[model samples]
Target: MKFIDEYLSDIKDKGLYRELKFFNRPQSKYTSIGNKRMLLMASNNYLDLCNDDRLKDAAEKAIHTYGVGSGGSRLTTGSYELHDQLEKKIAIFKGTEAAILFNTGYMANIGTITAIADKEWIIFSDALNHASIIDGCRLSGAKIVVYKHCDMDDLQEKIKVYKGNKRFIVTDGVFSMDGDIAPLDKIVKLAKENNILTMVDDAHGTGVLGDNGTGCVEYFNLKGQVDIQLGTLSKALASEGGFVAGTKSLVTYLRHKARSFIYSTALSPAMIAVSLCSLDIVKNEKERRVKLLENSKWFQWELRKLGFNVLESNTVIIALVIGNAEKTIKLSEKLFEKGIFISAIRPPTVPEHTSRLRITLMSSHNREELKYVLDKLKEAGMELGII
Candidate 1:
């Protein structure tokens, strides 16, 4: 594979190459890497429930009831009572008529989009939608029209230009890298006026938004207005699985047509149980998310006070733009050496010359730990000439 070597060399030269960093401890505000206890600031466990004992107990109980792996695909012998219960629970949580589960959020997006739209359809997607949505639109063989990020006017203009009866708009409820939320209320209005369908992948919003942590749909107070609601159990829920909530007919259609759902093995009973328990925790422990958001606001303000270009975000995900890929990596490395772990997001994940440090905060992180992180970031930013 000469081409593979060439590609690797090209990325290395461009400072776009990526490698894995192994963690020796459970995912939390603090974790160990190679015997060094590092402060974790780049995890998606926003509510800090990943290491909760209750979730562990739930998983263990489910494991005792049903052995680990799901025997087969959902349509086969893999279907369990626990799976059915979770799906029903998800529907109730999201305020939808029904719901279906997938192996991951990526799978859910790719599967649902392809299942709903095809060659005859046109998809008006947000410019900053997650890559999974982009892939799903591409695989569907539909004409994809990308509007400017979170610009409703651009969407309206494109909607008028791309005329199709079978048209739907898909967007990420909360963009992962930029940490900005899409204008779902305006999108829903446009969809209604234009007679188009709407889908929102609330992967980052689930368990971290809305009064009851029901996600973006509830956050916007447009409960039953949106057509398809997609989410993941992995983020704040601290579990592993993806799901789509919509009308019963849509769930039925996806089960028959979505290849990712029809072919992949069902999620294990233990993971499903963990998801179930975590959802309950998210509902009961609203204070966790409340504190998480409060700390995020304080943290972002502090970063700006240090002269960093922090993006405007209401969610826990924060983006501190550094513009240069190599410099961003250097800043991350410097911070790591200072006992903090924040990811350097580079090209392809973000726009060129817009490399950034994607810092995420957990509810369990206190002011003392955050102040320490800010201090470290200030030192690194000054050394790298980022501030």
Candidate 2:
């Protein structure tokens, strides 16, 4: 406890201390934090389907039919009809021959990476990949090579020297912190030339990118070419699970060999139902994606016009880098006072002196809401001398 307190003090002194903030209701364009109703720019519910009636109806029906929980792992009695159905749907959605479900996106990454690679193999990972991917590579006992963020030349150079029995390349389709798209086309080309297996975690890209919301693989027309596609149900899909979509053989192998999937409890019926409904909505609703993209472009353009640096963001997520962690926190708090709720991302989550306001857009956010948030952001930026 004394060591923990010392560490806490160090974090606090460095301006990296974080505290949990509670929202009293379900995620939406607006959320109630304590007594204050704030514009929710920090949520990952890109499609705003978390509170959608269709998902709610499906969830209620599922609860009535399948009860509250999946009492065992997928290898055991927990493999319900809904679980199977969702996996099949996800496979189809991702343009893969088969799919396997994991309890969370974190488990999916960890399990799949460790299951496939080991001491004999080498893994080439992007420097800016999610923590889950980093942990997975560590657990795999493989030689982990990290290329500079989205630097294909660096990736190619590093991967060329590895003469291992097997080689794997892992990257995020969308970098979560920088809000930039990976050069996946070039990565795929390099992987193909080197006979390397490719895995993309399209957590933020699913239900938002590509034609028909299939994600970055489909967006770049590399659907069948990418060896493995991993995604989350929780972000844009408004659900609670993750899936690995690939060839039938790959799915079968992971189902049998992936420790996380074999040992972890299956996702609940309600969550599965929500993903099913969300997928259907995503497939049918093209307008939402269009509106969301348009909004993101407009917001970023306005921020740039106001002399704020919005670096290379072409998606629903945008980051306004404010340098110092203390200043970033101050800007976030100042904006919060004006009823906007952008999150301040600091060190460990991001590099030191590059702390920022991570602004995310939802399909449900309209022009009026965007204008109001932008106005507050300008005020906050000016007050902090960040613009």
Candidate 3:
């Protein structure tokens, strides 16, 4: 009782304790979070297809065809026709020999990383990689070397210092917090030069990057250069699953050994069906991406002009640096009250003193809503003395 009370008290004192906000309806540009129906700008639905009628219909069709769940682990009785079709489609979309799906992106990253790497391998990871990657590295039993954030020279120096034949360089294709893209252009070149295999967690890159939405490798025009590319259907794909695209042998290896994949139940049939439709939507509808880019660029310019410290987010996930967790949380709550719902991101999600309001834009948002969010943000900034 004493220990629990003390920890709860400390969390309360820090103003960092979080709880769930029940979103009443479909996730859109203006939807309910908690009691307020605000201008929702904190979602990763970059193409705005989550609530699309086509995807909804696809989901319904899947439910009727395959029921609610996969019923067991994939190797057992779970691998249905839907999973096989989805896997084949994903491989074709990603230009890989094979693709494997996991229930969640976290599981995919952790399972794949931990399964492939062993004591013989050395992992050189970017400092700002997603938490899933960090945890995966820990479980991999590989000697880890942390390089400076996106610093190629530091990565090179580390690569030179290490003398392992099985050297693996892992990085997030898009740094989730700061929203800056990785130097995949540089990372790929260096990886090839050093003969080190490369793995990119393209969680934020798929369905949002590249012409075909093939992710960072395609975006950077480094398709075959990257050995492993991990993508998620949850973000821009607007579904709930993760995939690793690589050589047929690599994916086959993961299928047998990855504990998360081996033991956990497969993704629902509805999600897989919906994800297929999502891919089609991404390919056919270019307007969504155009609108998304316009919104992102406009917001970034306006936020900076308004004298807010909107960091180097060249993509969809922009951050307004509030510098303190308490202030960030307070701003988020106040914005919620005003019907402008954006989330506060804090450490260990971000580095200390870099607490921010993680403002994400969606393709479904119109110009008026974007303008309103900005104007309200201005008011909130002035009220909070951040301006």
Error of 2 at 114 (Å): 0.4
lDDT for each residue of candidate 1 in 1-387, tens digit (9 for 90 to 100): 999999999999999999899999999999999999999999999988888999999999999999999999999988999999999999999999999999999999999999989899999999889999999999999999999999999999999999978999999999999999899999999999999999999999999999998888998999999999999999999999999999999999999999999999999999999999999999899999999999999999999999999999999999999999999999999999989999999989898999999999999999999999998888888888888
* Worst lDDT 10-window in candidate 3: 29-38
Provide TM-scores for the models.
0.99, 0.99, 0.98
Q: Model-by-model lDDT, in order?
A: 0.95, 0.92, 0.88
Best of the two (2, 3) by TM-score: 2
Model 1 regions lying over 4 Å from their true place: none
Report the alpha-carbon TM-score of model 2 versus the true structure: 0.99
With a 3 Å backbone cut-off (N, CA, C), the pairs that clash in candidate 2 are none
- Model 1 TM: 0.99
* 1-387: candidate 3 lDDT, tens digit per residue: 999989888877877677778898788777875566767888888777778899999999999988998899999988888899989888888889989999988999999999989888999999999999999999988998999999999999999999778988999998888888899989989988889899999888788778776778888998777898898999999999999988999999999999999999888899999999998888888777777867898899999999999987767889899998999998888888788888899887898899999888898888888888888888988999999
TM-score between model 3 and native = 0.98
Candidates sorted on TM-score, descending: 1, 2, 3
